[model samples]
Target: MQFLGAINFSLPLLASATETADSSMVLAAVLLSLVVIYLASKVGGELSNRFGLPPVLGELVSGVVVGVSVLHLLVFSEGGTDSNLIITFLQGTAGLSPDAAAGVFAAQSEVISVLAELGVIILLFEIGLESNLKDLMAVGIQASVVAVVGVVVPFTAGTVGLMTLFGIDALPAIFAGAALTATSIGITSKVLSELGRLSSREGQIILGAAVIDDVLGIIVLAVVASLAKDGAVDVSKVVYLIISASGFLLGAIALGNFFNKSFVAIADKLKTRGELVIPAFIFAFVMAYLAAAIQLEAILGAFAAGLVLEETDKRKELQKQVIPIADMLVPIFFVTVGAKTDLGVLNPAIPSNREGLIMATFLILVAIFGKVITGFVVFGQPGINRLAIGVGMIPRGEVGLVFLGIGSSIGILSKPLEAAIIMMVILTTFLAPPLLRIVFPDSEAVGVASELILNTSGTPLAVESPTAINSKSNDAANPEATPDGH
Candidate 1:
């Protein structure tokens, strides 16, 4: 009987050892993923710099190469058998049963979702920080018209095209079109900045339109999310979403304005040495949280916060501190996104329920044409080049990918669909730099606009110069003024 007891105790010990080994294997897989992501990002950054392309384009392409549809370096390797193995290992590490593993996978997917959310937020924040409200205001009217047309036209076209050609469901087609509405300003800004045209009139219009695009995109996303939950489009819910979104925007702007004054006062009072960097971060987080509570994106809040503080004396100091943190955390978000993709899944030989090639091609076309046609909507402006503007809006960057990832996670899109969306993002991003170079060869002469300045009453003001005034007066009073200001 004592010998039997000893055997029972030994059996438990052996089982524990096996469990420990499984945990170790899970940890090893995660570590490998990290290493691969880091290396791929580095290689991409270098190549982009060498090719005079945006670094983000390189990073995204690198991800595609490592993703499921391509080289199969990671993620969906060996026909998704590897992904299943990794998921299984992760499940075992969490002490989950097979049934519980599914739950765990669902929960872990949230982490990726949150990272994607944060990535877009930070990206928008950077765009906001770099934005000049005055410049946006200068082009506000034209830009708003263009932004609306840009969104409406492609959306209508995409909806019609998908329904007519593919006969896909209406909701899915709408969702796909909605996905295309976002203009990744980060890539555009990067390209413009590199070409020394960020301050130009055309650039300013694009930036302003992009800001509006982001706001509209979020509204569309919320509407789509609501429709997905309800299983049909609810006009009442959409109305409510629009009202809430408008309120959120107004509240953000008001709160940011209020906080800007109060925080500046507090910072002035503190007068601590070393630039009071902590306050800016505190402001960023608080505004971000506030925005989230109001059902707006945190990045919008961050951007609003930046916009509010743009004119303050401490603006440079605040940017200097916040940018470093953004720089570090933002790339982790992108690299992780890249790492999650499984390039090997694209193979036609995969015998599964996945719709690989057709879906990918459709998505790619949707992503491309949606932004491309927006260039033609420019009107009443003689010197403005709409083609350059459209090309500038091409890159999907963090925002588009975030939308794709979210749709994928919620079962709105299948894995192959997710891969296809990612391909669209990568291709669009790759096309931006070279296309912009060709379109805006003399980028320096482009005269980029920076910000849209709104008066205290919330009305946008145009920058009228003495030359413009004199020319107008001369045109009315003296024909000679046309040649030289009278």
Candidate 2:
């Protein structure tokens, strides 16, 4: 009996040891995955920047190279039994059996997926920080008109076209159309800043429109995601989503004045490291939790929190501090998005791929034409490079990917449809920067416009004289000048 008791105690210890080893293997697999991801992001991003394209494009291309359609190094279960090279590598090095490796792979993927989700939340928060509510309001009616048109036209046209032309169902078409409505403010704003057009009238309108577009896109995403969950579109859910999204945004802004003060006071009194950022994230996460509780996207709450915090005196420091954290996480979101995408669906040798290729072409055209037309609708601004405004709006960039990721997650998007949307995002993102430079060719005019002062009405007040510019040379640089482009 004493010997039997000893065996029982030893059995529990052996089981605990086995569990610890399994966890260690899982962590090793995850670390290996991150190694691949970070290397791909850096190499891809660097190459993209070298070619005057967005770094995100490079990360995506790298993901494609490392993902299912190519090397299979970063593949997931959704990639359809495509062997993960990481798992194989671990098995060879760590002496794990195939069965054990599979379990490790699943757990590793889940952890990475969670990290990717957090990356997106932080990305939205950073976007909210950069989007100044005051600037959005300051841009006034023209920007509003442009933003509204930019969203309405693409969404309406994409959804209707997909339904009519392809005989696609309503939800998938809506998902695809909703993807079209995003304007990658990050991509567009970078091109504008590089061209020194960021402060220009056309630039302001583009930036303002993009900000509104982000808000609208999130609402649409929440609705579609909710609808996808139920597998049917309910009228009541649609109405509720619109009201909740709008109320969440409006309520956040309404409470901003009070929250800003309390946040600063709390932050200042902490007298510890991360005083400002920790509390900010706590608020953001709580808001994200609340949004999820209300059946909305958690990202919506994160974005709203960023918007409110942008009003605080700590906005600039908070923006600076958020960058390192974003840098660490955001690439995972982007790269994982690329990894899950199966480019095999786009192969023309396969008969079924023909439809996807055709749809992709249609989406590319709609993505470009839809946004370009918004610039022409600027009613009061004469010779405002309506073309430039339109071109600036063309790149869907990371924002489109976010939409694609959510759709893909809910399984609302078919394989072909998903591949097509990815193609549209890639092409639009690639084409926009150079196209923007071409349309806004006169650098001298851009330089002049950069110096022009705008009234509260967003009308160009006057071109500042040379002497007036000289007088302000000693003034401190505008704290808002260098925004986080990501």
* Residue 113, candidate 1: alpha-carbon lDDT: 35
For candidate 1, lDDT tens digit of each residue in 1-486?
Answer: 000010011334434433444444434544545455557777986687577655555666676666554544445221223344445655566554665443333333333334445654555565565556666666788777767776786667766776787676777677666666777765676556545445456677787777677667766777776776677667775677567656765675566555666777888788566445677656667777876676666666677666666656666556556565555455545554454554454566774314646766776676666676776776765656688878877776556655664565566765555555666665666677778877875432222122222211112212222233224221232222111000
lDDT digits (tens) for residues 387-413 of candidate 2:
998998998765676677778778878
Mark the regions of model 2 whose C-alpha exceeds 4 Å error after superposition: 1-21, 159-179, 182-211, 214-233, 381-385, 395-419, 429-486
lDDT of 2: 0.71
RMSD in order of candidates: 12.2, 10.0
Model 1, C-alpha of 250: deviation from truth (Å): 3.6
What lDDT is obtained when candidate 1 is compared to the true structure? 0.57
Off by over 4 Å in 1: 1-39, 65-120, 254-261, 271-275, 342-346, 349-363, 380-382, 397-422, 443-486
Best candidate (score: TM-score): 2
Please give each candidate's TM-score: 0.71, 0.76
Model 2 residue 272 lDDT? 83
